[model samples]
Target: MHEKIFEGFCISSFILNKKLKVALTYNLKPEEENSFEYAMVSPLSKNSTTYNDTFAEWDTIETVNSIKSALELFHNVIMIEANEDAYEKFKKERPDIVFNFAECAYGISREGQIPAMLDMLRIPYTGSDPLTMMTCLDKARTKEILSYYGVPTAKFITAENLADIENHNLEYPLFIKPVGEGSGKGIFNNSFIQNKTELQQRLQQCLQTYNQPCIIEEYLPGREFTVAILGNDSETEVLPIIEINFSQLPSGILPVYSFEAKWIYDTRQNPLDIFTCPANIESSLQEKIKGIALKTYKILRCKDWSRIDIRLDSKGEPNIIEVNPLPGVLPDPSDNSCFPKAARAAGLSYEEMINKVLIAAAKRHKLI
Candidate 1:
């Protein structure tokens, strides 16, 4: 049986109202020598479409704005560009906390890059630790851990190249996605494959596009939902479940949440209309989703905050699709971002939600 309470850790809190100095961090992907665009926008390049955004696609200004909005209520917050120089600067300044949002620097060790730096500097930061970040980056590894703990996830196989796909006995109608990406980076309408021919084609595309291993899992063609978990491991709180309503999606497009649907600008093609918080599903199913999400969070050692994506099978049972350690917090009511929506459903204002994370971390040390 799973333990009801998290163990092996002691909680300590820092002094309250100490004028805590906080730093909000973001990353700039190193310019790709061969590709014309940065690493974040490379997928859109294939379609000959330029990915446009408010701050040139994941720029520091937008990231800082999001951080400032979230941290303003807690203490004096400073925004810093995540880099070697920035790390040095942060050490010199010595902030009380670092709001780490640096997903990656290049095509290299993306998530571990910044947390590793923070560790070397002995700086405290929000979100997952470097170990958790590294483990979660490789989707296959995360799934393996979950499965080892008997957590419910889809049958999946990972391959570094096309030759790897030939040896595995994976089920049909598989979902192909990059093994190490977030924000639905490489997922698209064609990501769901029905037969060997299409599977090989998608596999080749994934291998060429990501230049990394790909995870192919048996597709769960049913309702899609997301559950957000907050607080620390010992006292974590499960937020309301959110569902992706694909009823309005154009036929032929797989119900899978794709890059186009996630970041593309086209309204008709985007699937924003399909998202609903406190997902209108059966109470038993909601409880199941909550239970599975909490289990994944505990097994993965995810702390502070995390989001788990799930899908319901034809039998209405939930299957773990993916785990998001650092989810987006865009508060624009029109955007339909899951983190803030879940926060609102849990009775937190935008400012309160941001402060709550810091409070949770501070209270761990008795700071609050």
Candidate 2:
């Protein structure tokens, strides 16, 4: 019995040193009178308010307290907000590791910006590097790379403006989305188009609303499954696949995982809306999904951790959708998201999951 337990170990230990210095980096709310005011008055209990109030908009004291709790296993964790002078601060007191969670600030690069800064500084951080982060942010670019790597993905076209769709070759029933935004931003039920006129109209709306190129892809009209990938390269592990059950979805809806379906889970109060991890799927299909996720993860050169969004086509083949380089870490038991959910399925709690990722990075540097 003891040998059976010992057999489960990987027989390798990379992290040998004591707890390393870690900086929990996050982006501060851009300093503006209106932004600051909105932060102050936002409802603290609301889920939507959590993004602004809980992380970026919260007072420094609140953020520091939160970080301390998250990094309870570490020896020292310094809280650093992403700002103009943050790089200098990082240089002066370079931490052994950086827990980068800077989503964005004031309509800037948001996700890729801080990672790029860290790349230049040569500081070790969790998550994908700058290039992968930038490519994945632009869904079009991500699909293109996946395609080049022979990964199956839905057919898509890049529409720079309304005029560009005049002679486009995309199929009917297309899904329009912002080229670089996430969290279902700029995606709504109206994004589905069945004809040329609706396509042009939605294209115009996306252009005007997002002020950026709109990506148009053929709607898969099939089940949506998300695969959560952890670790890097040979050591990588694929968590149980998550299948988004849309049974609660209203009839006639094409089942787009819209912003509301994701962020408003508790408000809807529907258990079916939640993610069913280790989704009930055939053994063959499960293997297929795992293979696709692993292929996409490697093709993108994603490191430390990442999550791949996938959808099954009419023929029941897994097609690559989008890659999330920096998945959210909302530890609120009320809002346990996918990344953490998968970690729990793997027998790791929130704190253990965080440390596991840090250890993965340390293994890469042979500095654990």
Candidate 3:
């Protein structure tokens, strides 16, 4: 028995040490791109509120390099830009596994573009599958799934046109944002609509600007928290919870973590004291948040890792704001990225965090 157990352990160690080829697929932001160019090209170029958040969801070269560096520590790393040629690249190289976080720029199915290709090629990748990726990107579809599972989520309606907003009977002070965006794209202080006229105007603006359906959700009034989760079923680990302190935001700005708040105001030179890790909450509340976050992760079929945004309702119950299967990892402490921040709070270095995600995926693929 002892010899058999020892043999099994040795084989496991051998498999773990066999370095695999890792394709670091990403959508890199154009180095020279600026807000002026975005605004000039925007449909609402005449509107001053138009800011250059076009590449907001894409990763910087620094971020892609950082992830590549981390993976190189243990495996052979290959960089693949997620674009029209990405499918051919994957077909040619066919790495052992893909560390995919390609937020492709285009249609409602943008986020799932790379994943769908990988699926067709029968290649494994990190995070959720194509269906889950597309669903989570479409906030309305995500909310619908959550609601169907009896998960707590804010009441919301998708407005493709002004008539959709006009037909809604939901109460006022609602939050409006592009249904298929992440990294705070298309979200701003004015996203908070107080009355019918403002809602109609904002809805029209979003439709014309974003050229996509907008989800108008009944705004939750209590404190907000974002939970980062890692691993998979039965062994999934919830990292330290991070609370978004609205009080720390620039005064007079709405409490929402809009594009301006995330990218403009909170810079490395002058960072906003906005996040509180391991949020000062009762143990019961922590468990509640973790429970809901894990349930949401599983229900959405999120694999490897994900970050779920939760806010408290008037009754203080936690309601999921949105789900991020491909959570951002900026790799800089001062950048104030929530996933890395939460992982740091849980005592994980950025490199460790990245490797853990890869390991999870490799294990899932039975590659390790």
The ten-residue window of minimal lDDT in model 3 covers 35-44
Cα deviation at 309, candidate 3, in Å, is: 0.1
Which residue pairs in model 2 clash with each other?
15-368, 16-368
lDDT of 3: 0.86
Give the residue spans of candidate 2 off by over 4 A: 1-15, 28-68, 106-109, 250-254, 265-272
User: How well is each residue in 44-90 modelled by candidate 1, as lDDT tens digits?
Assistant: 45676433221222433443576686576446878777766776877
Measured against the true structure, the TM-scores of the candidates, in listed sequence, are 0.86, 0.84, 0.92
Please, what are the lDDT tens digits per residue for candidate 2 over residues 1-368?
32232233322222254666888787544444455434433443566422222232223333345546656544478877777777897898888778776675544266777777787888888888878887888899999988988899989999987778888887787888888877556666687899999998888877876778989999897898888887887889998788887777666644777654554333223434456887899999999999999988888888888878899988999998889987755554445367777777777666666666776777776665
Each model's C-alpha lDDT? 0.73, 0.72, 0.86
Q: For model 1, which pairs clash? A: 12-364, 12-365, 12-366, 13-365, 13-366, 13-367, 14-365, 14-366, 14-367
Give the Å shift of residue 129 in candidate 1: 0.5
Candidate 3 regions with alpha-carbon error over 4 angstroms: 1-14, 33-47
Tens digits of lDDT, candidate 3, 43-139: 3345665676777888877788999987786779898999899999999999989999799888988888999999999998988898999999999
Error of 2 at 149 (Å): 1.4
Q: Total clashing residue pairs per candidate?
A: 9, 2, 0
